[model samples]
Target: MILDRQLLLSNAQPITATAVSTNTIDLAIARDIGIGDNLELFIKVIAAFAGGTSVQFAFITSANADLSSATVIVQTPAIPTASLVAGSEWLRVQVPALSQAAAMQRYIGVSYTVVGTFTGGTVTAGLALDREGTAYYPSGLNSGGF
Candidate 1:
């Protein structure tokens, strides 16, 4: 069976998850992704503290999940000497390329830490996949010829 170009699936969305002290944010794969596919992972860190505090953002994943994962794709200096203002404060992390194993059914995880003091905060993260090449082609195509 052949697939058409329009059958290709390319989509992206935002996934937000909360982060606690020394805890990892488990991210679920929205759909089955193929190898060589590009995925962007965004991480937002919102610090909630009574006084000034510091926080570090890190990216993590599971080996058992059969997905290649890396930490600190976009390495940013630790957030320090800042007060957690009311509202959503965050940092964004983007993973340009993604690697997948032979096995299917895999997911990614994100984790963070607060170096200073904060009552609580939220860590928002998500994945975006590139599906440009996933399209199918029809056989036997004829162009304007004599």
Candidate 2:
């Protein structure tokens, strides 16, 4: 079951360059994300390739918006060299399980890298969380059940 889904990208801009790239937009997750819920990131790629062109997507998360400290949730393999044919591709990342005792606001998003040259290379991505059937609940004040 899927819940709490939102678009992570700020716009539909196609990145067409022969270099490693990063998106200026950063996705924000509120501290209220339900504990133990599974978080996932999805990327949709549309590209028209030429001259050995290729693209890849990576999902990264940081505890701070500045991303001074960041970790990769999904390590994507570089796309295969293109045959110069337009096509669509998909990539995704599933965040590791989270514990109620270790919850915090998270910053999550994706970055794409292009090799050689390409045109009409665009990417769209989003984030979703699936509620878990069971979760840990820390003990609370027990004064009422004497």
Candidate 3:
């Protein structure tokens, strides 16, 4: 069987607080899925600042109301680790392929942390997804014969 998936930007709030610190944002989705399902996540980040800054991205999974137990599935490309000139948008990072095993049920989310020094700034992030199934069968001449 094949499955189609889509990831909508559920949140896009501006960053109000200032000061050098790490901020984590989380996005979650719940649905019934099976094992051997392939999942791909895409992310786009826009930075609006005048000074240098760094950001870290990660993908995680969790159960209903149990975010504390969330597990990290993948970490985004290494931090830019340089001066992010004003009005800079980084390329979208494509998360590594993730397979849903029998242990996983309903719940997937993306989390990220933005850390840097600045007077004040705003950053925006978004996510997209694609999915497929993994199943194979060998050619056969008949139901009971090879």
In model 1, which residue pairs have backbone atoms overlapping below 3 Å?
A: 4-136, 5-136, 45-91
TM-score per model over all chains:
0.44, 0.55, 0.45
lDDT of 3: 0.42
Tens digits of per-residue lDDT for model 1, 1-146: 22222212211111123242232223344434433644554443433443335655555554534324443334345666354333333344335434433321234444445564455544444454532224555777654593
Consecutive 10-residue window with the lowest summed lDDT within model 2: 18-27
Which of candidates 2 and 3 reaches a greater lDDT? 2
Q: Against the true structure, whose TM-score is highest? A: 2
Q: What total of clashing residue pairs does each candidate reach?
A: 3, 0, 0
Give the alpha carbon lDDT tens digit for every residue of 1-146 in model 3: 13233343223333333211122222233333322434344333344443435555555556633334666666656454353434444434554433434434345554545555444345443343343235566786356653
Each candidate: what lDDT?
A: 0.40, 0.52, 0.42
State the displacement of the C-alpha of residue 101, model 2, in Å, after optimal TM-score superposition.
Answer: 10
Best by lDDT: 2
Off by over 4 Å in 1: 1-30, 33-38, 45-52, 64-74, 81-93, 100-107, 129-146
- Model 3: how far residue 100 lies from native, Å: 2.6
| Model 1 lDDT, residue 101, Cα | 38
TM-score for candidate 2 = 0.55
lDDT of 2 by residue, 1-146 (tens): 35443445423446676322233223243455445655665555545545545666666566666544556656667776553234454565565554322432365556666776654655556555642245566788456766
Q: How many residue pairs in model 3 have overlapping backbones?
A: 0
